[model samples]
Target chain A: MAFLQPLIFAIVTLTVFFLAFKKYRVIYANINLGKDEKIAGDSGTRFKNMMLLAFGQKKMFRNLTPAILHGFIYVAFLFTQIELIEIFIDGFTGIHRFFWYVLPLGGFYTALISFIEILSVLAFVGTIAFLARRNLLKVPRFHMDEMTGWPKLDGNLILFFELILLVGIFSMNTADMALADGKYGFAISGMLYPLIDGLGDTTLHIIERFGWWIHILMVFGFILYLPASKHLHIMLAFPNAYYGPLDGGANKGEIANMPRITEEIKLMMDPSAPMPEEDPNAEPERFGAKDVTDLSWKSLLDAYSCTECGRCSSACPANQTGKLLSPRKIMMDTRDRLEEKGAGLREHGADHDDGKSLFDYISTEELRACTTCNACVEECPVSINPVNIIMELRRYMILEESNSTEEWNLMFNNVETNGAVWKMPASDRTSWINELEAEAEAEDA
Target chain B: MSELMASGQEKEVEVLFWVGCAGSFDDRARRITKAFVKILHHCGVSFAILGQEEVCTGDPARRSGNEFLFQMQAITNIETLNAYGVKRIVTTCPHCFNTIKNEYPALGGTYEVIHHTTFLQGLINDGRLKLKDGGEFKGKKITYHDSCYLGRANGIYEAPRQLLELLDAELVEMKRCKSRGLCCGAGGAQMFKEEEEGKLRVNQERTKDIVESKASFVAAACPFCMTMMTDGIKEVEKQDEVQVMDLAEMVAKAQDLI
Candidate 1:
């Protein structure tokens, strides 16, 4: 069984990586299913944004308390990787404290472990605070209508995983400290060793082994669970931030232009321009997004990068005013539809259709309620433009389906014939000039 | 008003005054247009209007997902502006400012478009416009509502607030202002239709914030916002207590230009 332990460890590590990679491929394929968008240029600005937004967690600081708590978990996650490296080495070779043996530094190992120990304690506190926020405080954003079943559970599960992993690390360290008579001089675990010192060496050894097993097993579980979890944002946030809207300029409000529509309009407006060579077998270009595939790949990336934080929904005017539209729900629905279709396509062929589009998941009422004020886009801790998705669906409804409200139709008609949103003629546009002059003349009199 | 460039009559003006559809027709919004024009006139700034040659920029149409109509309107306006060799424009409406400044470039209309607030601020900077001491709005409580198009869409928050500061008014802020400001329910072409069934309208929610600020006057920058906030103030029964005035009107009063 002693020899079997290393064999089992290697097998488990390989299986987790294999499974996680398999799921990752599906996500990659699903994202590529979207229409191509040119987010590849401007690497300099994109890299800067990734650093500031993702690595720096700049947007999270919009609210102070959660930012600090999130900082605790984020910092711990980064430091935990140091200890994990040693754990992986020890598991494979069946030699405990592999780094302690290999590293040439005298007290460096103790100091590093002590720092990680302190961070783990803070991570524990952060996890508990987050759990309290979800369950006890029932923060309005966390308890929004869309966060009912799986989202709520997934959020709690993530925290619980963090909590349990912290417990496992401390348990192993404290027990190992007692067994080794506090040889490592690790701060938190060394302090805890005194209470457990009365136990015999064999008992301490058993406890240490048990703790080590659970910690390693949980690591594997976490990796397997992440792809299916909204917590995947941890991995996806960097890329999403890199590909987010970077033109913080006068054109930030401009929606993307459809090249097909541009070409068509250009041809119609100028008969002298050479006619486009038509391909009879080609499928007609979609006017706007009806299904997830019609959306740009960046939008699909946004769907995947969404952590279900509800920040967008919390700040959404439509949601604030109690409209059916919730930007968070829009992202969730996009991801849900993608998963449904992606899974089917992955199993069957690319031609596989679920007989359902994104409209099945997102209602027209929700789409119509959006103000396109960019409130949701601004509030998002990660850059997810729900307005872009809404506008695309709206474009589909208007251009492909010709479905629109009577008022919008009237406004369109007015713009077409009268050159205004109202029925007033274009000749009346400068009538105010006459009135201003008349009022000035009357005042002079 | 005589400064307007008449049909087929050419004059090299400093800038073109683009009176958007609301500023041209809506009775309330027309006053904003007048106030802005008065300021330009008082400053001895040479400006002209497209008059009947100008049409809607199709802001509402584009926002309502009618891209074809919007493009048609945009191309026609761009052609007309290009024909006149219009190099710079100043608009009282944020919608027109945003559409022409931001959206028109891709459609072949590229001109230096300035919002009235930014234009007025620039005038004050150049010593072209001066605010009288202890003017009509001196020491008045004024809260400026950030229009989505101007504030968030184009990052013009400080320019409007900066103009408000010159008024000698006690500038207060709503709970949501600047980048986080609430919508007045007229953006995204919602002005054309009734709000989709919600517990309350967006403008009503926004008006609640304005009332909470307890300001005597709410300054608006966009005609759509002007319409929404005015109706919101009336809906909350604060129409008598609080007034919704555009930045141009406030500035005009402060400068004694009207």
Candidate 2:
């Protein structure tokens, strides 16, 4: 019990430290947040979306086999917390019988533990399948691109984590088999008791302690390491899924109602109004996002929350058709750039070099290659809208930097002149509808 | 079509069929539209033609990121419909139906929009329209391309296929058909705009799949798709082997054969 108390304290303390570090580095940061304020407001629809996406795992289930395997593992991991707690208690008190008498349905407990044992094995098997599907199978459709930076290492790390979890679970079960004499709480562990009987008591105790420590340390390490890795989905997925737009709705068409162009001119000339360039300390006019600080807090959270699962890239029509744009890469670029900037600020004590911005780092060629398709958002398990981010960047490029594709400029001109993308005269706009009875009213009275 | 009028009020008018931009503009589509109108009339269903007065439904505008223009066109079309007292609209173009039904409501345009396939199916079920036994021309396997607006946006997959079945054509489906149908590089105004920097064209990819299916004929609900797929077929040098026809055209051709 005394030795187990130190383990408990270490786990709790580590959890607090992990949470604090995440809050400080990600949640408190203003630069990475999206510019949109409406995202913060609570809506019933958003809550429903969250429930469907997180608990229901609606998006994940799009791929049937993987979804089922992941579902089992997820549910088992959740319920197995009870077994972990019991292990910790038993290890500390040296009384394996503590929970044995409390459970009214002793048989049910045994059944549940046995079920968990089966589920754990299934989870291990699923992990291997996932690894092969991602790495060994080399499914061209699932292959990561150059922009998917460090995917091989990330994939291996996840496999390692899952392997460690499986090893610890089996070792714990073996230890439990050694400690119990006659009846056991779990069927699988009970079945293994005969095998443990041959091993001496001292050796059994050492193995039990070793398994306990290994399991605890691994769990703690996972918790602390989550915020830094692609596995950050463990913490951010629920919120990201919940906050996603409802019903996979299209983007709102209306622009923000700013001061009218007509009013701006009037105000500039009025004697009562402050003249242009008169006040030296006047706030700089911000047409679009100029830097990371220009983004909203939710956008920042989005950056940190990205799971890097490559689902977005896999589903992207543009990527599938051999376009330069990969939605996964877009998210990665933002996150990596932000982290780089954050590190720079930390190292240089706010005297950071302004030679390059995130835009500078992410090539314009890559940005222009995007078709503005919503496939990424549709397929994303966490519901991150990469299309919106790309559009925002486009807005910045056009309004602030005066950088835009010639096609966009021409299209915009055509739209401005003819009120149509085809650049036909406004008079001919109703030409196609001219023959229908509706045409009479469409024409001038 | 006669039964359709019988099911309605004593007035003989059954439906107001809307011939959209591509239907009127393209020669092949125009023939299909004329055939569809003639078939409907033959069924004893009285219908009114809007003629040249029927302008664009603003699908191209809305999809091309010109929302303002879409709204303007929507308002004009709605006012036109109100003036004509149009309660129901049957359209050959799925894009027109989607815009008039789904998008128009936001712009205060309200009218019951029905795709031609649905209207034709309803007429057939009600015994107004009869399928003429064509005895299968060319004995060619036919695959139906589900338009995005019709299939995914509005859930009108079965009706078109059902119409095809009535024609006695063997409906061969692609591996990714119906709800997961590949876009023919036409929707969202990709038809008018230059193709983005993708290695392969969307239409080419979709057409390649169609070619691989080895179906001699590809039928679609949207004229935009018909145009794109035909172009794709031509590009792949399968122009002589494969033909692109609208569902209405296929139905009309089958009716003529009978």
lDDT of each: 0.88, 0.66
Per-residue alpha-carbon lDDT of candidate 1 for residues A393-413, written as tens digits (9 for 90 to 100): 998988889989998898898
Highest lDDT: give the candidate number.
Answer: 1
Tens-digit per-residue lDDT, B113-225, candidate 2: 89999998998999987876664433558898977777756767799888878877778998667645666767655566566676887778788789988898898888878
Give the Å shift of residue A117 in candidate 2: 0.9
Summarize candidate 2's per-residue lDDT along A1-445 as a digit string, tens digits: 4676556756675666767587446544534434555663367777788778876788888778878877876776777787778765665555553556655757777777788888877788788887787778886645657424465577568777877876776676777676667355565666666777778888877776676667666776776676567777666777776766554543221122222222343464465875444457876545444455455445556666777777777756556677677777777777777777676776686667756666765665555555433446656777777765565565566556767556655655654455444455545423433333243356545
DockQ score for model 1, please? 0.73
Cα error, candidate 1, residue B14 (Å): 1.4
RMSD of each: 1.5, 7.1
Error of 2 at B112 (Å): 4.3
What does the i-RMS of model 1 come to? Answer: 1.3
